[model samples]
Target: MVSVSASLAIAATLPARAEDPPPQLTGDWGGWRTELANRGIEFQIGYTEEAAGNASGGQHNYVRAAGQLVLGSTLDLQKLFGVSGATMQITLTNRNGRNLSDDAGLNTLQQVQEVYGRGNIWRLTQFWYEQKAFDGAVALKFGRVTLGEDFAAFSCNFQNLTFCGSTPGNLAGNYWFNWPLSQWGARLKVKSGQVYVQAGAYQVSPRNSDPDRGFYLGWEQTSGALLPVEFGWTPTVGGLPGKYTATLWYDTSHANDVLRNRQGLPLAVYGGDPRREQGRYGVSFQFQQQLTRPDVADPVRGLSAFLNITQTDRRTSQTDNQIAFGLFYTGWLDSRPRDVMAIAIGRTQVNGRYAENQALANFNARGFLQRPEAEYAIEAYYNLNLHSGLDIRPNIQFIRHPGGITNAKDVLVLGVKAIVNL
Candidate 1:
């Protein structure tokens, strides 16, 4: 059961006003969705589709279509059965289709679309129980949970994965899986005024990512645990609201070095031997601020900017650091108050040691060449509010040094996305 405070906390950063009308698609249920929500049971269903392709300067030119479906529900125990401050949530996700980056050999760190994944399959994403205490000042949640649901939360208004939820996903994907992937975990948070501090302990096991293990909960193969702590501050700027968050994470599992052998020599020079180390860690910062507020005549008109940055342990990760900045403008036109436009740029720095290893490999195998250092991408999009429950977005992206490899040519990608709410 999700508490009222929990719901409000999640919606705090959204640009939508509280007085906005309910979605028309939900109203089509004969007011059943609203009625159910008022009675402590809330249902959610949504579908998103993306078509993307690299039009120029890649290993190849190809287009791909991807789609995802999400179904979820939340229950408030306090309202339904007088259970004090208890809440529960359940969610399932289904993903299918091909990835444009893979098809076109872009080899970029950021995905073109947020819906792309490893496979086309249905999986249980979240089933968590939360309890609040001390006049809603403290809360506890546990079960199959996702890190993104509570920590460093951000909206996915852009098509580029770089601007999506959680900066750690780009810096530490091995240990910090984002939404649509849940693991056994628990989180505790305490709120005081506009500030909150939270910490979580999550299971770290590669088996949890196996699509075939959907809904499976087994601890026998667990390698270790990931501990994350976050501090958040909410403030008002020029009468507009904003949120700033900083998070740190440490994983207790053993991680293999990407480039070095046991003797600290490059793997290419050590006949491909491996070296393993323990204790991986990373840090991330996120800031989202509304620069302008909407007026009575344009309730949905506003502008906001966001920045995300992350740094990971260089010894075990190919990408040592990543930074992204973006701006979002809603109600670009007076007639289309729900429409949005945005642009963003991101850079992923290749780990120096890993680049040296690759350079050594290339020199030994063929000839001499300078090592790759980083990859950069810029993306822009316009979202059209076709209907109350539907949005269509057209996007373009420019990639320089795809995959952080010099051999990969600069590329331009075009894409479109459609989302349906039910």
Candidate 2:
């Protein structure tokens, strides 16, 4: 019924005139018959490194790599193809994993640390088929596609925290391409003005040499009445393009990946651990405001401020309760074209603790988005328990008034943080 309603809405928008057909062999969908011609590429490169002066044993240092690439087309597919349209895309991230401190909680050499140790990455960001309704009110997308759940296009990123970068986004990840991101499956979505909805099924990721048969299913909704992200109401203003948005997403899976990419090459599983059935669902709220003028503005001509919070409930007993709050701002000085900078902060707390790994039983229990990067962080819990103290991972080595486990010397990040779109 909802699909039918969306189709009607889309049909209402498209021109009823008998439009010229689209190109053949290319599998074109819409706009192409009368108007079509668009293509482009995008890229990003970054570098970062950090070293603490002192620690429980020695100093700490962390290095990372991040990058992306985007190829877009303006040609409509419907006008070209009688059925589905075609668009091609690809994305990848090459990263190395490193351990913060050795068992002694002291300085560990980079050589001794293994960022994924002997691991590598290559994600096929996007490659799918799309079809637009004659009315332009509804569109159908198949193949590896982004489920644009809500503010995922804006929120769900935290370069500062290692945990915050889950494959990148999740409507399954934010960045164009990354790991533990969206699964390979079929998805359907609907959009009508300010309201949106979605349904999807995915082959879940697995662990180690063993694998599981896991899959996903879910739905979501969003409205402009209240911006849950920022704790208040804001509207995207014609004056500033700032507005508030509220979003809700839920997903459940009872399947897993057997291992293999489209080409039959071995690919990693999606998500599942102690529990045979993997379940993950969360809700988010956000608000954004762009402070700047179009014609004339400061070097920092445009400033966008946004915040989001999400909580998760999982069916797996090993899975920890999760909640995340993020605050961020981005812009450039004097509106310099290539000169841009951003600061983002997030806080997350899990049921199990690294320090309590002994009591918890499973220390290797994986962590996700805001996974307790640092104890006694700036936003979450206040006051430090000097007795039990707090723990700082490789990523959270820098933020704070130094109260957790040791002196300020132990938390300092300095180095190159980079990404490239190729």
Candidate 3:
């Protein structure tokens, strides 16, 4: 939902050559758009929709649709109030519709419709202010914000949840809130040359995920805080840009154990309160590079590859870790220079302790149950650039062992995604 905004922020942080303006459906609002931008105020509107159908292997074949609409604006404080190096952003989102993974009985660990969660309601997604100093080498931002907007973030080109957005959020979503979900937070970043380091802290609590709490900003139910640190390197390789990053994160909230009770006995068998762990932690790495380009001066047309790996606290996480890799080729067709073709594969591993707990539950019930080990996902899509500010992507997805259940039937899904910039 925040893909467009997140991309803008990411591009601003990295060094790049000046380029032409991004396309928009509305043509400069008859020159008023450019005038507002020149005056330090720019408005933004984006809409994204996803429709998916389970063609086979799910409990029942069905189709579902979900969409998000974002309304926002950016204020360049340097021009608006004569405060150099200051800027502010405010965004509100409206999300609605159903998730096929659950409604169609797929029960997949990763969603087939990536955009179909976090409640169907209105939300104040972002309200943050940032200041830069040292000739743009240092930046500090605070207020209501989402962690994945600036940490462990990745492109959302794929419709499958496994290969979209932040890996840590995919694994440890209980604490690591992703896009469309904002919490009180602050971040500090310092960049020197091609290397940069950043750290942040964000409020964590179950209240933040409540549908009715979309616009609630009180700190009454905050459990603790999430801390994350990242180091990154952006370099020009073979005259092409590449980014590599590593991050470590810890959540200062008590989480329940996956297998045992407070006295160290099997919770499934003993039937008591599960043990509460002190905290949760994880580490992740991201790599992306442009492999080749027919036209050296055309930065938009190239073959790019990305890899994301993340490991979370096994004691509290159902899925302990994941590894995903993908390749996207832009301008592969001479007739459709703006089109993109991409494919990705990913594996999500269930925590061993959680698997054991499931086994115990099955044994106690005297019923046969397949122990979950891992789930694998594969996807490919051809993005059709129908217009300068609109894109339609039709994709196919395959899932093996839905929900990591070893004996679960594999699933095949057909999907399409539409993106519009207004």
- Runs of candidate 1 with Cα error greater than 4 angstroms are 1-28, 294-300
Error of 2 at 345 (Å): 2.5
Position 224, candidate 1: lDDT? 91
Model 1: how far is 79 from its true place, Å? 1.8
Q: Write the per-residue lDDT of candidate 3 for residues 128-209, one digit (tens) a residue.
A: 9999999989999999997887888776768999988888989888889898899999999999999999999999987888
Provide the TM-score for each candidate, comma-separated: 0.93, 0.51, 0.96
Q: lDDT of all the models against the reference?
A: 0.78, 0.31, 0.85
Q: Write the per-residue lDDT of candidate 1 for residues 164-191, one digit (tens) a residue.
A: 7667876787778777778999999999
For 155-249, candidate 2 gives per-residue lDDT tens digits of 22223332232211322221122221333455454556544454444443321101121112222221111111212233446655544444444
Candidate 2 local lDDT, residue 373: 27
Per the 3 Å backbone cut-off, how many clashing residue pairs does candidate 3 have? Answer: 0
What are the per-model numbers of colliding residue pairs?
A: 5, 68, 0
Q: Model 3 — which ten-residue stretch has the worst lDDT?
A: 9-18
Predicted structure with the largest lDDT when compared to the true one:
3
lDDT minimum window of 10 residues, candidate 2 = 1-10
